[model samples]
Target chain A: MNKTGRPQDLPLSNPRADRVRDVAKLAGRPARLKRGHFLVEGPQAVREALKLHQERLAGGEPGVVTEVFASEACLDRYPEFEDLAEGTNARLATDEVLAAMADTVNPQGIIAVCRFVDVSLDTVLDAGPRLIAVLCQVRDPGNAGTVLRAADSAGADAVVLTASSVDIYNPKAVRSTAGSLFHLPVVLGADAAELAAACRARGIGILAADGYGSLNLDALQDENARRRLTGAGPASAFDLGAPTAWLFGNEAQGLSAGELDLADHRVAVPIYGAAESLNLGTAATVCLYASARSQQEPAHGETTHE
Target chain B: MNKTGRPQDLPLSNPRADRVRDVAKLAGRPARLKRGHFLVEGPQAVREALKLHQERLAGGEPGVVTEVFASEACLDRYPEFEDLAEGTNARLATDEVLAAMADTVNPQGIIAVCRFVDVSLDTVLDAGPRLIAVLCQVRDPGNAGTVLRAADSAGADAVVLTASSVDIYNPKAVRSTAGSLFHLPVVLGADAAELAAACRARGIGILAADGYGSLNLDALQDENARRRLTGAGPASAFDLGAPTAWLFGNEAQGLSAGELDLADHRVAVPIYGAAESLNLGTAATVCLYASARSQQEPAHGETTHE
Candidate 1:
């Protein structure tokens, strides 16, 4: 390959280089917090970080993405990355250097350094959010990331991770989010009780999703059906479309009795099969989409019932 | 710890033992194909294998579980495993031995050797199936496993993996299934075209889920909505509740044009938000649950609309 302009920078051949070591350390929670930055690995995540970074810089806000490192092949495959690197410290590195910096065995030939972009709970609520997903004490990184992606796909306004929840910056969690971390506001380390109180004050009814909840999601849908048949609008019943905050619990042990009590209505995704229950991520997706469908569809139409 | 009964047997301390080597080799495709056996790692998988083994034996079928190995801690944690070992060969091994024979860094102290449990496509279809999940060229083990779990949760009759799909017995996929592998019939390595034909011959409608499909899932729900409002009952339209087979495609390249042509209807899950699309597993879960809710609910009540 012919060497040109920016690609002529010496390839980072040393895995022990200080820059590589610093990026590698960001994989750990302590390192990420201490440095106030996190590593975004793989092509998808790096692309998303750059896209969001450009948006923030355009809005005159501090850029979330500080640096972009790519191999010649990666930059060639995604020429847009070069443009995305315009305002950032973009560097050309050997594949080995990128691997060393990433927590995964393979970093897909690109990685980016991004500052922590978690918004404050006050900021998330001040936007007057209607649909939100609050993960309470969810410890699995993969589950956390999947919920974030699902929430983002469901067009949720925000996602709040309670203090006891898994760190959203965990590389596994970030990888699982599939770049959704950059799509919406994600609040970390918030107190669950205080957040519940805040949501209630803002008129966002909290619905706790648990296996043993008093409200069955099916019954809620039935209520929607009856109301629609009776000529009531989507706003008349407490179905999935209501402005609400869904609180999902831990993987093994679900929301506690006290946690369940914090919600306006405790809801369970109805299980019709022999399988005991849906996993946290799957259940949360179902709940969020239910609400999304309710809120998006017009009253007395093909999509109104559920 | 008291070394009594079978616990007194010497631990298989050698990681390089011939048995350990053979078990470890099963993780690869060639070894599994040649030996007609695969490794089921972790407690959840092993427990499911043994439980299903017991059920098969009771049903007069050959036992699928051939052998089981566990650490003293794992055996003690689940005393039921002791009872489950009645007809199968069980051995106590050191944790290192278990780890060496397993695929993951930690196998949670137990692993089971199981015969390939895939049934013939005809066998799956002959049972008059109402619901099925078909994966076409899906290469990710985790996504494959998750779809199996979701399908099981939704009470599907069976799951069919196209010839190009990932192996269901992959240890990572088995782990992701969370024991759902034993809960339902998983038919692997079937020709996609033939599977579609079999589904058609059985009067099962195939709904292909794609991002750019002509039919919207919400519109399918709307079809159900119009039917219910008009008192046509749940059986009147191309709604989610109809007896159908849901075909999902590869993670990266979705169903090809040729593949999509095989389905009765190409359906797209509505994207209500800005996110590009839902991940394969999450989208499959939503599709499966939609059908489940449709099939399981009474024809005239609260769950009727969805």
Candidate 2:
């Protein structure tokens, strides 16, 4: 604002002008994503970023944020920005500049460049790992994001998007996740075969969802079958306490035959209506919830509480 | 192609153009919709309409289709038009004349007028009656469409969108459904309380998906709880075969407290990621699949027959 003939009093424009432009470009390009960084625009995502920053600061680590930008009006609207402004750099931009940098219409007037937190399979396994969703070749960013959101809300251990899936850092995907992207380890570009093998090695059951599958998920969760699927025997047998990975496929083709064959179990969502198939994201969500339900302990009995 | 100055071939400059203008106006006016009529333009939807008409014809019912409009090129592209033209009325319009009635960009050069199909709850319930998805106040047309598509793929009995939801007939919603709209019975404009009651009357356990709910879906599918929810005696205690309905709420507010209270059970998708919530459609898909899984029978031992 100082040099661009805009209001000089706005704090978000001058200091972060270059960074905002970089974020805008980064959002459209996938190669830049491998740098282990991404842009989070819109007010909701930006607010989540700031909240994460605050949490990190409170915990004694310097916030990992790269930059933040907003219109002068936004800062005034969020008065708590004063505390946020203390250790980190926050800049003001004119509404026009902010809009130009935003991916959404009616820009939320705030944006941030953030470093992707390093989340490894080891970290997720260390957590009380019960459920996880693995997206395979899901090309749509919105679908991928929505799946991540479901995984977050369902308290899955982690969400791993395979190499062929949409870029998790895509702004559309990030927006669709509704802030779940920040709360969990969203590992992208994992080798599917290796990841599947690793999950199996760790006692995780790979449940693949297919439209043509003979086994019904309902059958899997049946009392007798549940005993077999979760009964203790060999480490190779299905174990409910061990991590479970739900494999979802592309929207058009669904899971490849090879991928489906690799799973320990193939499950189908029964259809009594005329629909040809459920959308990939929806299918993934349903499968994840089903697996979660199948493994859940009886309500009246003593068990670990969520 | 017949007569240069004929009403069908002539542009709007013709003195008799009022009839054609009225036909085009019918597409936009709600009064026409209220009259149980709607227009389908472009070749895709029109082609689908024709297929639906053929299916009706095969079923020994007279098709209620009113008219078809096409340019000479369109008729020429599908020479069968000449035979189908015998019993049905076809107006040959010039490109400009056809453009006047077209609803999309780059018109597909074909249009059809047909009576709207009225589907009721009883018709859907009687179709197969296994799995169903009940949408409450989902405002996004795209989300609504995606849910319909998912329902079709998952083979749900029907999709019931509450009165507060977006219009199912919205063109955008129709397009988003990817032809599933025509294949499925999508009942819209039902009151939430009334719909819940109807589901209850049918012995369908209304499971509401909410993030803050204390019960995980895994717990709901447990043998004893499922038996209790379905009110099935101890013999089928774990048999969750009773009809079930999955309730998904608005994108922003999610299920209202009142709606959640009305549900037989409130279940949550556990989240482990940073994003806050799954999109409405994704949540619906997950919950529907969970229900489907819980009700399906296991396949392992059933294959031991001769």
Candidate 3:
């Protein structure tokens, strides 16, 4: 915005403009990889991208967003974007232009071009995270994003996607995150075996979410509760309150034998009804929240000690 | 060959036949409503539909599946389908014919036209269910289906979709259920207030899932656990272990004030991370699973009796 806090220029009316094409190309992998940038569309995601960008700029780090295109109505509806997009190259654009530049038919009249936000796995692990979610070969963009959003809601310290997983920067994936993509640290394209080893060395137990696993997730959590509340139960097979990383598998095949082998234990979210099995997102939400609740619940240490 | 249990005759090759068009029309609401039927696509869903049909027929009840269409390859791949489809009006079709009759790009070689399976709210409550999930104005078909599948996984006795909620028979919704639709009783087009009152009359407590509610789901679950383990705690705001119905709202706007007013208590699935709120399916899954676990936990009331 200019000194008056108005959009910088006349609305970009040409949908075929070189700038519009450049922005749209970020929707695909080739351009994104070449330019090291991805698209963040709609008000929620754009708002989050701008917030993170502003936060980084304030912290003396390089900003996350490079450019933002928003229609005047979007600016009017969400005035916070003005301040959030202050340091970025924010521009006024027509709906036609915005639509052309967005992967989603409805970009909610706003879009942001952002630098890839994934951090190195080492950076995430270095923070001593107590809760992490690892996705193994999850191919659906929407499923990946849903799991990430669930992870964020569960207060997971980080989210890691293995090499064969769908790109979280894929526009649908970003949209599916509902803006949680910017809320937590995400590590993409890491090797599952290496991740498991590093986590193991750090004492973060890896629990594979499998349908036919020997250990029941609810039973484990109940055991944890029994220990926390009564202090009379035998030592549980697994302490859910301890540091942990949960391994989630693909939408179809689930964790492979090799992938399951890397985990300390294979745990199944018990299906109470005949569901065959839980969807990846549902299973992940249940498992992550179980760990979150166990780790975060208030300790009645007196009962445990006696 | 008929006695030998082979696919009856030549495969359907004409994609433009009247039968094909009639079957394909089920993808739209008008067609489904007119015929009082809906499409169940994909192997898993078709298998579930066939199983339910077989079970119903065995019980001298009207079968759920009205007609079945599959490619010979699909039947060959899933041999159990032969027995499952034994009494149904099963027909073999070419891939082209199957695609023409399917809503999905790839129906995975099978689709079934099944009668609308939703029952009355009174029927559901008459079962004396221990747990139920009620969807209020949930618009997205996938979201509705995901919640239903999650509810099924949680072993919820039934699911109720209030009037104006997305039609669960929408192909996307049916596909999202991933066979869980056949596993549980569902009530659609339910009046929220009336349903709430019915549940109340049945001694079932209503809990609305709200992001800003006063009651925290985790806290309530913890209190239940403490009481279950220690047999001593203040009387909880609500007993999660009791017969209960959870109200889930729309994807974007949560429960309206009027809708929230229908519940005995409004509970927030704790947002332990920076997420603005949990997605409807995630929140529903967490809430329903919490109730499921509390209700399903083995009773150890020796401490409570004292």
Candidate 4:
């Protein structure tokens, strides 16, 4: 739709063709950064990317998705893909060409080139978010993506990935997100300290999800129970139902003392079994769901005294 | 430890050796079945395998661990591996040979050959399980492995993979378990319908985890709340603390209608966000944790009335 003057006219068949090689280069971080583009593979992610692009275009902004490549079989099965690309860019390629353009061993017949979609930390902060997930130095792509998906599923306003975290544009992470990446704002390269300060300034409580935290999650639940039952209410315990930002740390080292000190509360999801710990992704999901459940519950009136 | 009269005297340096090829072949299902053995890669899995094998050998049963291959560097770093393998078998392998025996890009310096660990359905059922995870037609090896890990972490008694599910011994699944394969009993290739019937006969409540079920998990928690608050309890609503087996389904199709009908109650985890649904592993974690939290709580007196 940008009309850069060159239009593809033929169905690409050669996997080693220059165009295919250039597109395939987007799989790596350096190339993606250099070209200012990333690859979106598979029908689900492509569909979501196109939909978001259309919304941006209608809002008078530059479209994020620049081009789509699909095989004839893929187009035949999902003709709506072609219709979606009418105002943008589209091309037909052979299965081998499409596979070459993809990162997976078995690509499901479609790929898209899109501009980087990360928003600034200020933009995320200025929105006055009610729920957000902050990943500090998360290294695994799948874990990062799953946490993003869990945050999205919990209806978080955004996800902030600190500078040391794995690149969100990593193909494996994108694949693991299962389209949730396009569903919400994912802020990258944020400074953890600055983000914490920003949340504090916004009157948003920060809860650090740490394995060794002194505060047990079930005890919090029990506190909520006693508060509700005895009418000794909210002030007696930290209220998860309030607007909050959850800070999760590196999968291996978890939060440092400095990082833990930055939060309003440090909470641990109780481990009832013998296994050493919950996987990062699973732990984050349980935490997010706890917040979601708590926030959805009807608010109990707070007592003036603690 | 079997003392088959063939003691390995020299370090194995050839990656193309026939013994190495036989070990590598265990990565495939056919070879695993025919040889009645599978490859357990990396130091963590190898450690667990050797420990379990030692336990079996002590109990006068056939050892599960057949052979352990480790680089001298690895054995030097962790002398425990050499000690653990003393009763069984241990061999020095060159880095190249170790890498060839491994399924991962980096095998972390060790690999072990172990017998299949699946127990009979009757064995699992006969134990009068307090908690169990039933996987019905779960096809993704990663998801299956993750669910197994979560089940183990929650202190579930065992994990049963139905007949149509992915092979639990698949190298990818084994890797995803992260050494949890040896943590608890994992029953494979079970019939879902028959398992449900047996669970019923044993007085274990079958709670089918369905995305579209009318009974919301939050509502179940609310019922628990009322039971706790009023003390007029137990018989009116399902008690998660009681003996229960959770039934989960495939990654894509979920549970079929017939599968849903087989359970005593169908439950859904409440989705608070716009994201479609929780992935299989995350959903199972939340469900298992809920039961774990309930069961771990001090028991409440049951009402005699139905």
Candidate 5:
């Protein structure tokens, strides 16, 4: 070990090494469950993982990034990694070794093996978060990851996935998130009816993103704006600015009827054109942004009703 | 030919038939280009194609669906196809033949051979369109199709793809569109420079979706709402309610320098959280929806300002 405890000297040159295969096994679910770690690929995701790891370490918490592997070229391209990898189990590996260890065809010369960062639904709810996004039986890894990314973009406090959802730690899902997986708290394998009940008890409203819902999302946003600007509008069906959790459904069939029944309101993103419905990611983005915008602190000096 | 003009029976069951080979070949680019036809798979897509074809045929114009193939099970599941595919060359095929002729592992027992529906850029521009989405160098077929579907959901008048973008007629692209391909006009192989000029000539403002852009999309929408409600806000940088064309760049690199320079403004969809930026489809959806909502006919009896 280096005297300064900064990772420097390991030269990992063999693609067929046991260590490399162990890292690569994170690509599958069984291996991930066995090791309690997942693959974070590409430069952007690896950077975020390292940042989170350093933050946790500073807080005297266990680090999130267990191991980081990079090539000299990658380190040169992204010099920040040198400092971020401080005290991390960082190794300089050949491109072949890095590729062999990563799930992606090209992991941008950097990959991180990160501890599973998901927290309990109780942990998320205890924070009194203003906004949360929940996925219900969403089967597509790409769609699940896209929603998670969109949730992060909207500044969602946490994202919850139902038990039937595709594994969030799936390699393709991680890549689709574009590093947002590290940006927000995540709750895995949540039970929707129980979660909805917990939210209601906490005074958090539940809204389902439904194609057949009677409540139009645009109407709610317009009303929120009207009340914000002129201090006058029709009585709102639901307060958009209030703490809320939005439930998004599967890509093809959308939310099941039971899932819809649990929400305080089933809100449909208005389709202005002839499209029957928006795709899952698109719908979730629009709905979350609607809540985000309305919940944003009033721009002027006016007092907020909330 | 049947006296009722309905597809009485084809009884086609040979998977090795030349007709099956020809249909299957449409999955490739060369065959599609040579015949000027694309494969439309899945029931929802085929129904939409059949509707468009019947509409054009009723208008004394050429039909869109040159051929339709379906199984009895599919027809039983989606009874509307029986009426929709009328007057077209519809035929019954066995599951094996249908599978052989399809691009998808399962074409859901229905597939259609459709003529390309993309229109000329001039046709779109001359239609006095209020809103359009232009994709520049977007290589992912799924990304391209998602944006197209989002544009349709937002009621965009048309969607334009720069020459460098993926071929919209590709099967994956068409599948991702979920039948929105037939919902709105598409202009393929457009030159971005010429398109910007054309839009300008038509009094349309061009906005590029850029991550580092100085303009915040949320701020613009806020100003738009203020102007609509209280009729007071800072002189807006740009009007969201005007005739506009939004330019979305590639998924990875985004719009090149030249593409960015062509826009009247580069508008960034606000990343309220730690996400660096929204993915291409998400960004395009938010941008298009903002324009669509702003350009919507004011619900109240407000007088016209445009």
Candidate 6:
């Protein structure tokens, strides 16, 4: 046995190992989540955790990873584990034990237990961010993950989850994010008032997308018109002040009346067809992409080839 | 029992009942689906099946309802069952029996066995003369449903799914439509070339949404613009030609090269953020809504509070 009391032998597979597997599943619960602990399954999530760990190390912070496990074969596959070996307490377990710990059908052969970092609204602003997405009461795991993935792709600073939003660390949500959860700062359980205050303090314009909103998103794309619209910056630039928060609501009931009332402006995507509303995740992507379009310079080079 | 020679009385809490349920499950298989048969469960889907039957009756077409079963209380609550009694056979079963036949938990107290309507591309065009969503290969059920629901909300004439697309009648797809599937013409397994040819014959411009396309969606929305954006109507009026097909593709692969080649013009939603792409459903919704916006007349009158 190793000093930590776990077997040092290359794969610990036994009936007693069930307790260890149960510990990984505990990460799915809210209580464990609140305790700042999460289980990273498979090599993909663990590799991402290690990447983040390295970034933190370079930035002069203690590595965030607490524990890591793999079979001897996994260790053999990744022999150059300089930083990982030094920082993380590694354990060798059997393939059966790893599979038992994994939530997915195909395990990636590596798992890590890590501490969740608290990303405050200030951290997002400090990251030199320009755009952010605020999800209000979005309960579906798939939608939440898609939004996170979209936010990361849009180069948004962070994804702020308002009260009642699905947990970011939910295995399904994490899986859906396709590794974007690691790349982006995800703030959960934030209150609307907190979000509003943070945006207000950051000089960020809060644009709420309501179906009834008078402002057409297309009109906002007009470079000269948008400058005239907001009465700020050059005609070619989008000047919604320092930062911008695009607020999205639940899939069924969109942004509430109270939330709409707090927005500096209300916007709507013009619809010609019979759809009552766009899906919540899709709407956020469109809105975020629209904002990005409004702010960026026109692209050069061959756009599309035949 | 009802002269069909099939078992009319379902035995609840019996091992044999499980086999009957298994038989019902087999009804959703592709062979059965291709043969124009599908199982309906819960009150909503069953109610929709009945309504479709009624519409067929009123239209002088052969009603495709094969079987209907309900608890005594369900029959009493619905009451309007003259056609159900006259045209198709009906059976009264215990709640447990009904549950055994049903696919969902808390079954809405009803179930139906109905023939799927093989809605043809020509029939879809004949029904409506204008807008259409021609899905190239949307493989996600949720995305397909969202597009269909969006098409319905946009008051689209029809939603045509090409080969390789997800089954529109998949329970998840149906649920995602939020009942819009029942109202709209959702024709599945269409040939892309045939659809493009049909739309061309109708003078409907085929606008494909390509991320790398040269034409911007906003540019198309402008009245003075000369180059036509795919899936868009003429600038002067909201009336998009005779009919238009908005082609969307798979979530990951997007529109195929051959599919893009068939389009009248490739159009794109400009992105300012880092997201490599929008989710398929979001892309379709945005483009579809953009087309809808282009067709909308200026809203007038005092905006009523909701």
Candidate 6 lDDT by residue in tens digits, A1-306: 123323255566652465565646645776455667766776656766777787888899877677777776766665544345455777777777777776666556677777775488677767766788998988888899888878776668788998788877776777667667777787888888777887787778888987788876655554333243323333533343336898888877889988887788888865555345666776777677666544442321012211
DockQ of each: 0.47, 0.42, 0.72, 0.44, 0.65, 0.28
Candidate 1 lDDT over B120-161, as tens digits, reads: 888988888889999999999999998898899889999999
Provide the lDDT at B234 for model 4.
42
**lDDT (0-100) at residue A253 of candidate 6?**
84
Name the candidate, 2 or 6, with the larger TM-score value: 2
Best by DockQ: 3
Local accuracy of candidate 3 as per-residue lDDT tens digits, B1-306:
243334688988999999999999999999999999999999999999988998998899999998889888887788778888887788899999999999999999998999999999888888899999999999999999999999999999999999999999999999999999999999999999999889999899999999999999998988887777777776789988899999999889999999999999999999889888888888899999999998887463343323
- Best-first order by DockQ: 3, 5, 1, 4, 2, 6
Summarize candidate 6's per-residue lDDT along B201-258 as a digit string, tens digits.
8788888888988887655544321112221234533233335688887777888999
TM-score per prediction, in order, is 0.90, 0.73, 0.97, 0.89, 0.95, 0.72
- Comparing 5 with 6 on lDDT, the higher-scoring candidate is 5
**Who is ahead in DockQ, 2 or 3?**
3
Task: Name the regions of candidate 1 deviating beyond 4 angstroms.
Answer: A1-16, A229-237, A299-306, B1-16, B232-237, B298-306
Query: Tens digit of lDDT per residue, candidate 4, span B96-130?
Result: 99888877778888889999999998898888788
Q: Tens digits of per-residue lDDT for model 1 on A1-306?
A: 443324557778788999889999999999998999998998888888888999989999889987778898898787777777786887889998998898999998998999998999999999998799999999999999999999998899999999889999999999999999999999999888899999888888899998888777866765565465445434433756668899999998989777888998888887765566788889999899888877776553544344
lDDT at residue B226 of model 4 (Cα atoms): 46
Candidate 4 residue runs with Cα over 4 Å from true position: A1-17, A229-237, A256-258, A299-306, B1-10, B58-61, B230-237, B299-306
Q: Please list the Cα RMSD from the true structure of every candidate, rounded to 1 decimal place.
A: 3.6, 7.2, 1.8, 4.7, 2.7, 7.9
lDDT (C-alpha, whole model) for all candidates? 0.84, 0.67, 0.91, 0.83, 0.90, 0.67
| Residue range A1-306, candidate 4, lDDT tens digits | 323322247688999999999999988999998988998999888888888888898899999898888877777677677667767778878899998999987679889899999999888878888899999899999999899988988889899998979999999999888888888999999888888898888888999999888888776865665455445434435877778899999988998888898898899988765556778888888888888877775542222112
CAPRI rating of model 6:
acceptable
Question: What TM-score results for chain B in every one of the models?
Answer: 0.93, 0.75, 0.96, 0.92, 0.96, 0.76
Positional deviation of residue B184's Cα in model 5 after best superposition, in angstroms: 0.7
Q: Select the stronger candidate by lDDT from 2 and 3.
A: 3
What tens-digit string does per-residue lDDT give for candidate 5 at B1-306? 233334577657999999999999999999999999999999988888888898898999999999999887888788778788888888899999999999899999899999999999999999999999999999999999999999999999999999979999999999999999999999999999999999999899999999999999988888777777776767678988899999999998999999999999999999889998899999999999999888873755164223
